[model samples]
Target: MRALFLSEPPFHFGVHEPAPDLPSRIQALVDAGDREEAVVLFQREAVGLPDAMIAQFRATDAFAGVVPLAQSTVYDATLARELSTPTDAMLAVDVPVTILCGQQTFPFLSAAAERLAAAMPHAELIISPESIGHRLDAHAATRILAARLA
Candidate 1:
């Protein structure tokens, strides 16, 4: 009730748009039964991300659990069409909001955070220097939020 934190939300809010072929290309990989590859492609195309961060993710214990998660995840034209929200809707949010995006995240995502922060009367935008691409720097975010909400 007091505050809100949105970490790398996919909503564009009309700030920017992703490449035209991005969704179809990723979906093609998925339809070919390569959801893992689709995930990688999305990361790469969405933000020009290097493989290092994804390699780190794959090395984690959580990677094994994501196979099913990835299989169930759908990224197609329909989902893409629904990702953006109106700026007026964002402006109508009455609570103080903190929108967090990685400095290395997708251009549209960073732009969305900036746009939301500007539109919302009490919103603050935080670009996490420690994050890579769209992944939040949980430690840094925790520290900042703790201090902020204290």
Candidate 2:
């Protein structure tokens, strides 16, 4: 299924580091003429994750592009909506907007989901796997989701 994944950073601060950190990332991306792409709202230092690990991120293809942001939804959506194209709007026409949040993204998940669900025709929260040495649960969730699509 085609999807749009958003993660509220800060919880996984141990996992990612945004290239520009939210506000700047948005500014840079928009300034760089990337308003028509999907941005990665990571939770920590993103540089740490290996390309093999994030190979699933087809932001350059599955998405128009990738965005690494900090923990600010205001900043997040501002860039998201502003740079959005008509086709971008159509992308969510019938596609499921799956928010793969982590266990650490607590109450914020609910609130974020609430906003996202309202904004998109299709959007739901799927608590990602626990962050362990191996992304066992994350992989499990991925397989489970894949099976659902199959």
Assess candidate 2 and give its lDDT: 0.45
Which pairs in model 1 have colliding backbones?
none
Candidate with best TM-score: 1
Error of 2 at 100 (Å): 1.0
lDDT of 2 by residue, 48-119 (tens): 334444455444363332343223433644543343222345435677666555554344333444455555
Per-candidate local distance difference test: 0.70, 0.45
Residue-level lDDT of model 1, residues 1-150, one tens digit each, is 788888876665544455767777766877788877777666555544568977876787766666555433345333544666655665787887888888887666777778777777888898889986667887999987997799
Query: Model 1 misses residue 108 by how many Å?
Result: 2.2
**Number of the predicted model whose lDDT against the real structure is largest:** 1
In candidate 2 the C-alpha lDDT for residue 50 amounts to: 44
Look at candidate 2 and tell me the lDDT of residue 75: 62
